[model samples]
Target chain A: MSRPIYDRVALIGLGLIASSMAHAMKKWGLAGSVAGHARTAETRAAALEIGFCDEVFETAAEAVKGADLVVLAVPVGAMRAVAEEIGPHLKPGATVTDVGSVKQAVVAAVAPHVPEGVHFVPGHPLAGTEHSGPHSGFATLFQNRWCLLVPANADPEAVARLRALWEGMGSYVDEMDAAHHDLVLAVTSHTPHLIAYTMVGVADHLSRVTESEVIKYSAAGFRDFTRIAASDPTMWRDVFLTNKEATLDILGRFTEELFVLQRAIRMGDGQHLHDYFTRTRAIRRGIIEAGQDTAAPDFGRTKSAGD
Target chain B: MSRPIYDRVALIGLGLIASSMAHAMKKWGLAGSVAGHARTAETRAAALEIGFCDEVFETAAEAVKGADLVVLAVPVGAMRAVAEEIGPHLKPGATVTDVGSVKQAVVAAVAPHVPEGVHFVPGHPLAGTEHSGPHSGFATLFQNRWCLLVPANADPEAVARLRALWEGMGSYVDEMDAAHHDLVLAVTSHTPHLIAYTMVGVADHLSRVTESEVIKYSAAGFRDFTRIAASDPTMWRDVFLTNKEATLDILGRFTEELFVLQRAIRMGDGQHLHDYFTRTRAIRRGIIEAGQDTAAPDFGRTKSAGD
Candidate 1:
């Protein structure tokens, strides 16, 4: 195990991201001690029972009191309130970072409350699963994944230290401006999630196709959408609300493209549909080659006995 | 090994489905002998080299001449030509079936060409990977998957024999009418694929987000869309073209639901967004509880060392 990066690392929310961070830090010995706080007493109790944190506090302020590294792991919508509660309690020279999906809104929400000597480096780790909460986290959740940092005018020493911590947790860290990070995530995460939620909702609302039929035959393409659609509802709801402009921007472009394909289907334009599909196929190849995803077919999914 | 379900089985269009079927049949001894045909000589040679079939014919007519069962595994658009070519050469008591995605269109295309004493059962196995071609097939590809048969006006004995063959190859067989099958697939498969392709296209065309950035950041939900979008372009093209009406219907419903959620985001209606997202989560739980998918996180996908 490596030397600890910080004497005390405090996580402000004990959900999947926070729990996973605690586990990864413990696995790598990257922190001297981990402290956690959850809004719900049940979650705090579970985190203690799970034994990922050395200490559990009922208040965010108590959690941040002696920590040199403070991580805001709450939903985007809850970031501001937690920041306000923990601002005065953060150690003078501590480094603060977040695990929010959108960078710009997070920066806007939490940056103002950071103390004069403290550093705030907004970040988003490009990793997750449909499952959520403390039980859903694993030590390898961030393994081989990208963690983008928006270190807008933060001190160089603080930025480097935060980067080292993420690297220790098995992430490849990159620095990007907050606006660009938000826009990129809008295209890559927020918008795709919105589309998936919409498609699954459409299936749910269709009266002619019973729910059982949809679930039974979901292996045919729809199941992939359902996986993403099943992601943490509150987190995703905050994502759309916080990154409104960029999400809407990508959504508009998506609808424009969908309409074109829809018209092609209606007009029986086989050539147009074939060309479009062939172009998209190349993108998947690029992703696999980039080592962002496995090259295995069907994401290397295995069937349960009754599937 | 199980008893042979057919004396000789003919598979036209030796792509993923046909190749997998051949492998499954061979694994279970479901067919005494397998005869295969493909439009290209390279594929026929590959089938022979792969040794899944007893013989590979240059034409469908030659392949089905003495076969007791024939499977049309070509793209939906090519079903008519394949049926027309092999119609006269089919044995008097043969049962002709297909693995096309859309049933109503296949029935319309192949029914007229079927001889009087022969049975035409249109079947679709709800199984596949993003990969295609003869090299992609595996013997266990159909294990625990669903195969729907639209046995319109076919003799009961013929349908039963076909069901037995699919069961031998490790599938649970169900029968549905042609129209309902087409509509159900439209909701569960075709339209979802179209949406995924369109969303990936939107990402590809975005000038602000470089393709490299999109690929690098794909693990944050976009990679799932890319998997389905990367499916065989020729097959999906034919699926949309043939299942036009039902796909269009579902696309309309999808857009309407998307617009509602889009409006909520624009209006900053968090409750609406949260409710919609919460409702869709139930559908995913149903899918997992039905044993259609694994409860493991991320479809139980194991990342490669570099991923």
Candidate 2:
């Protein structure tokens, strides 16, 4: 679809993000050749089966050799080990990047392992689905989605080259500091995910003993939370563990807010609850106005899907 | 779609549920004629503007004058007043129903006002969007959604007639006792909504003074919570206040579960979080398989509208 930005792009982890990037790059012809590797042979086989990559390797070191770009798409907790395994094999002057959710930790885990000539640019694509694994990747996952690039002290040419590649793949690129990105994501993604996991976990525990028929007759609202809770647990567990400070800070604020609302519910303070709900509605409107969210009714329904 | 089930149907309080019922009734020709009433003249005019009813009345008393079926669709808090205002004017042997979320409270509030001959069958249709007011209703709002009927010793024929009307409108009708309905809704809808509202409120607070840009970078997960949080504040406030006992019970469980998760995150217990999240995924899978949710990668996207 366009000129190739990198001669050979290698993905060191062939999971959802890696597979998606491979698909999008191949779809747009942004890379001369895309190669993939996974810790498991089954995933490598799956990647080859999906035909998103030109070749699939069994080892991370094998995958990164001679590639102009190497994507560390593994879990955040696995970043250090994966970087150590693939660092020496990276192509000279290669621009190394990652698609991990947490940035500051990823940078700390990865930067020291990179060779001096190679570039290390960390990014967090603010996009995903409830589904995961190699088969779950889709080419349009990054379209219109925000991809925050945290290129800490990297060569400007290398950062721009990475930005251009992301832009070519249909992502809206933004640059932000790692700490600020972590804090923003704590409020926007991490804390909310923890809360959703908590609620769904509560419902699931109730389903085991209680007679609310929580799953059998869950309404649209609870069902939405279930979808979020159903996301990959390993990734989320790693996320919470790695992004500890920011998530804990947001969670503390959330607990304080929850206690206040809980007291209001207990005291029958309708006005307080009404005021809070009304205030939150404006942020939802802001998200829609900013085109960050779809204005469609979007609760697994037909009429509101296209609106 | 079927023979007219009611000679005349009157909808009280022209909000989302009432306007939607009017549209659905008109869509299926389930009623010979439809009339609507709202305390606000603007709502009455808006109901008339929607062209779903044959007439729009200014008073609840005048609206149910000769109707064979009268739907009390006001907020749960106002059910008693509306019931009392219209009780004396209802046609003898008419079916009086409500689309309130809380069942026991509604029955306690409205049953005493119903005339001896009139059937008081309280109900809750588990179908709605974050939008509200007259303009937010749609003909397919109830399509394939569950409408729980809490007839509670109401005449069998009256309940059957109401079920038939809902069926004609494309909803799956189910019957449950009032207490059970409240408990089920507390677990499935009420607590989920309250948690979403709290999370969004937390996000809003952070966005004001914190340099996080929380709203601007809300990922797919948090955006879903914003939609739920953006629901009509008045309706939700009433839902919590009216369904106090059950909602409180669920909230207690949610807080307990949240504390455990917070502790786990603090202690870096990835296994605990993983097991909890993995267990919750089964409930989501069950919801999807039971046709209550969609498996179509619903991240505010274009797929899964009809699945």
Candidate 3:
């Protein structure tokens, strides 16, 4: 194995992303020691039981003490509180980064609490499964995934160091502005999740009052939405609450476009549907070519909990 | 190898589904002779070049002559025409079936044209890739998938023989009524495809207006929609047209439910979102328990064409 990238690494949240990072660190031997803390005692216990961290602490301050690198992996809405809690305990010359999906709010919330001489770099790894919690993590979760590093300033050395850490975990890191990151993720991640949740929620209600036939034949397309809808409830609630403006803006645009399709369907306009299907097919092909995600079925090699 | 299930098998409207069946038949030695016919002569030549069938015929009637089993694998909308074309040529005791998504319509369309002694068994195998055409087929495609049979009458011998045929191709067969089959598929398959098409269409238009940024940062969630959206355009168009009433009914319900979620998002209702997310999660668990699908990522085992 290569030399440790960091002397000590502290993770502030123990959900899917943070837990997966711990798995990656262990798999790659990237950190000297990995310590973690969660907001609740139960979660801290779960993290300990799952062996996600070398040391599990009850408080964020306890987790950050003497650490050379600190990662904030909580929901975007909780970044400010986590920053304030750990700020005093952070070692001087330590690097601070986050795995929040929305970057701008996270930076705005957590930046003020960074102590002098401690480098604060916000990062978002575009990798996760719909399943959450410490138990839902795997070592290969970040393999070939994209990690966007939104550093507060254009500091070449600090950025390179953070990039090295992620690269060790099998991620390709690219620098981007926090505002643009939020806007881009709003369209890519936020709006998509909202749409998925909305569609599944709608189908559920319809299934309840009607023939329940909606889900019986769910293999059509509603099955996909269910996977998205099944994502961590609290985390998604926080995502929408934090990424409000960008999400709402994109949602408005999506609504206008959906209305056009709905009208076409109502009018039996096959050309419109055909054109839309063809265009969408091209986008999927682009994604497959980009290597951002796999074109294979998500659960093909999945082993169950018992397995 | 096992003995051929039929001495001769005829495939009408040779496309993705029919071509795949031909491949499966050849690999499994399930048919001594396989003949294919499409509406277009070019398709017949292409089928011949790819060797998807042992023989390619110019007319459906000619293709079915002397065949003990005939499969109508055309677009659901074209079933009636194909049924009429091949009905007179069907062998005296031949078993006839279809691979249409909508069963009730196929029953109504084909039942009228079938000869007195021919067994008209409407079937839909829940197996496919997004790829289409004679060239886009593999013998192993139907391994461990479902094939639903909606026989017009409770003829146990005919059903048993058809079940054995699907089993030979590695499918688990379930028998049900034609109308119920259509309704179940509407919820599982049809509604989902419509929404995916609509969402992709929405994203495509959004990308055009936003100048391509929407696609540049497509996250995991939107990426899923793109895959579903990318499904064959003409095949989907035919599906919607043939199953208009069932699709329209489900679409109407889906819209109403979507409105509820939209209202919740606009009002910033976290509780509403949370509860909906929880409910949808249970449905996914149910689907897994029923073995309708795996919890793993879509087709995670098979490498993509690019790979």
For candidate 1, the per-residue lDDT at B253 reads 92
Candidate 2 residues lying further than 4 Å off, grouped into runs, are A207-212, A304-307, B207-212, B303-307
What is the per-residue lDDT of model 2 for residues B1-307, given as tens digits with 9 covering 90 to 100?
6679998999998898888898888877899999999888898888887787789988899999999999999989999999989989999999999999999989999999999899988888888888888988888888767899998788999999999999998888889888988888888899999999998887777743252366567765788898899998988999999999998998999988898999999999999988888888888888876666667775436522121
For every candidate, the chain B TM-score is 0.98, 0.95, 0.92
- Per-residue alpha-carbon lDDT of model 1 for A1-307, expressed as tens digits? 6679998999998888999999999988999999999988899988999999999998999999989999999999999999998999989999999999988889889998998999998888998899999888888889889999999899999999999999998999999998899899999999999989998999998899999999989989999999999999999999999999999999999999999999999999999999999999999999999888887777877643543
Question: Model 1: which residue pairs collide?
Answer: none
Q: Give candidate 1 regions above 4 Å deviation.
A: A303-307, B303-307
Docking class of 2: medium
Q: Which stretches of candidate 3 lie over 4 Å from their true place?
A: A40-52, A207-219, A294-307, B1-3, B39-52, B154-156, B207-216, B296-307
User: Which pairs clash in the backbone of model 2?
Assistant: none
| lDDT values, one for every candidate | 0.92, 0.86, 0.77
DockQ of each: 0.82, 0.60, 0.42
Q: What share of the true interface contacts does candidate 2 keep?
A: 0.71
What is every candidate's alpha-carbon RMSD to the true fold?
Answer: 1.0, 2.4, 3.4
Q: Report the candidate with higher lDDT, 2 versus 3.
A: 2
Report, to 2 decimal places, the DockQ of model 1.
0.82
Q: Judged by TM-score, which candidate is best?
A: 1
Higher-lDDT candidate of 1 and 2: 1
